[model samples]
Target: MARIAIIFLTFVCVFGGATFVKSIEEDFIRLPLTSLHSRSRRKADVVDPNAKKVNLWNDRNLQYGINITVGTPPQPFILHLDTGSADVWVPSVNGDCPYLCKAVNKYDSSKSSTYKEIPGKTFTLGYETGGLSGSVAEETISFAGLEIKNQVIGIGENQDTDLNSYPLDGIIGFPWSGATSQTDPKSTILGNLHKNGHIKKRFACLKLHQVNEQPGGELLLGGCDVEAEHWGRVYGNGYWEIPIDKVEAFGTDGNSLDSICGPGSSVPDCRATFDTGAAVIGGPSYLIDPIASKLGASKYDENINDYIVDCDDQTLGNLEFTFGKFKVVMTPGDYLSKDGNTCTLGFARLDDLSALLLGDPFLRKVTLLMNQEKDEAGLAKSNIDKPVARPT
Candidate 1:
């Protein structure tokens, strides 16, 4: 959720030290780039627009960061699946948004008989590149038959500018204070859903992909998607957490490289996290050669953290992990399909040390079902091999 400096500045004074929002009104106050809306203009109180109409819309995308297939035209969008931020926004008919962001045909609040302005819910988003300032107001929100009453949405200013390469309307975040703390950054989508009871005792599922022109890519909630559930019962780990089995190293000669594993050292452990937002398979560089050797796999560089492989090259193909007694395995086809003929793949040195973020490539192989209330995520083998769920 990239809010302009003003929004962040406002937060500094509020949650900065000891200020949780004093009032609902103070939550989204900001200085607009122009005098379009008076600073003194009050924000609107969100009302349940759907008290009248029921939308059949399904899987609306969360703007910014996270990538998913949202809304009509059904284009895949990257949104901020954050628990730290709130408000679901996407490009509108304003023709002012760019970077592959297309406006969604949302209901006009003006037409909603129940619409009411709480007065003063506008904000500005600041990103590393540019910024967007807008007003926050009440609006209709729904997807896959799941609807929330009086959802708070941000109405970004219709300005022209290129801020970041990844573009979208808004971020999906929830008011939460979970694993995030003063020492670490915070996010809260799960927390918010738990607050609203949208999710069961509290966890969600994510079945994301890296924007390919294929079917069966998405992030699920509460229950698992048909395709993602192809395997078996989903498993849960601490949200975004994984287990450490072992860690080793290798040299340029492709043999086992000698290294030390320690509690505080980077190269010494196999503990890692599973973040769907990331792009590539990242972890320690040292493990690359060693793991490949252990599997007897061949690698041909692709100039990036990727390569071409001969899937059936007699390498100790396929990798496996067991959480409890359940076995979740990554087959030869699961590594990274570089040579489709024999099922070959490749890897990249993620952090030079430490575990990889384990992004889309891996997520699609399994289902990450996080329990919001419990703050744990379950990992189950994907039924990807099933007849109905197989990719088209």
Candidate 2:
């Protein structure tokens, strides 16, 4: 599968009305999320020994992340919780490149008692915009109150401008272990946790809140939350991809326009991966072009490689995607991004990708449950009212 390069501008708009304030009764491990723009810090009220609440930082509505400690004394680094790829890496303090590595936290192996070097082993991951090249090493990783001993991790010696530009320290990929290039499947964090009996269930739930909302989101490990209203089975081995039956557009007339990507459409059997790392939706030009045109987006801008739409357009309605019997809808507010005075359609063109990539634009509207063990995913209208609590 080809890696899709992601491009997005920082935009601001309040969607989904006011934040839902509901109490969670279930007991599940909760990792609290903090917005990058938020100046105040809210503490989680519920506390459990098995439940760890880490501060997940939302970076300008583009990436959601959490802090993890590596090595013996537990050197902390804020890492992007990315579901699109599989690999864990942090910049090395000893790396020759100082410009990029100095911007964020770096791991120094010599300072840790548990750090183990995997000599001659190296890893490389390429994205559409940036890439990372590093050496393989092993250390104890502490996350969400669990310790993954001897977890394989990458020590970045070289970094790209795109990767270093972000405020994040590194990335913690959530894709299947086999999708990783740096280590054996058994060495991946999720793989090691399940193999070592650290987590009873091999499932996780992702809840991403609106950028303006406090406690940006929560990542629940071990089980799905009860808030979900819809469910869908996932396909493919590497990505958490679900079948997309068809896509329909609605105009101001409140009537459905012609649909695309079904049995009789130009493209059928379309699938999409929910990528937490990405900020915008990406799809083949065939699918994105029609949607953009119907939404009144201007001709494609070669400079940004995206279509621009009027920020005040009132005729834009909704885009609905069907997966089997479950349907997920994105209102104009969800698909349009406002950057300063210019508004751009949130969808991008990735002609070479086999499946559509649904990023933050789609994620923020729903609660997603991913069961890696069963290769299934569930979706629900996002009703995040409180911090996620561990199941008792």
Among all windows of 10 consecutive residues in model 1, the one with the lowest summed lDDT is: 19-28
Shift in Å, residue 374, candidate 2? 1.4
State candidate 2's TM-score. 0.82
Model 1 lDDT per residue over 17-136, tens place = 221111111111212122112112322111111211111111111111343333322323334443223344544434354521332232244445444455865555544235555555
User: Which parts of model 1 have CA positions greater than 4 angstroms off?
Assistant: 1-89, 92-140, 149-187, 197-200, 206-239, 247-268, 286-304, 308-316, 322-324, 338-348, 352-354, 385-392
For all predicted structures, in order, the TM-scores are: 0.50, 0.82
For residue 214, model 2's alpha carbon misses the true position, in angstroms, by 2.4
Q: Would you give me the overall lDDT of model 2?
A: 0.66
The digit string of per-residue lDDT tens for model 2 on 145-237 reads: 678888888888876644442456667878744554445444455566677776665666778876667666787666543433344566655
Q: How many angstroms is residue 191 displaced in model 1 relative to the true structure, after the best TM-score fit?
A: 3.2
Which stretch of 10 consecutive residues in model 2 shows the poorest summed lDDT?
37-46
lDDT of 2 at 32: 36
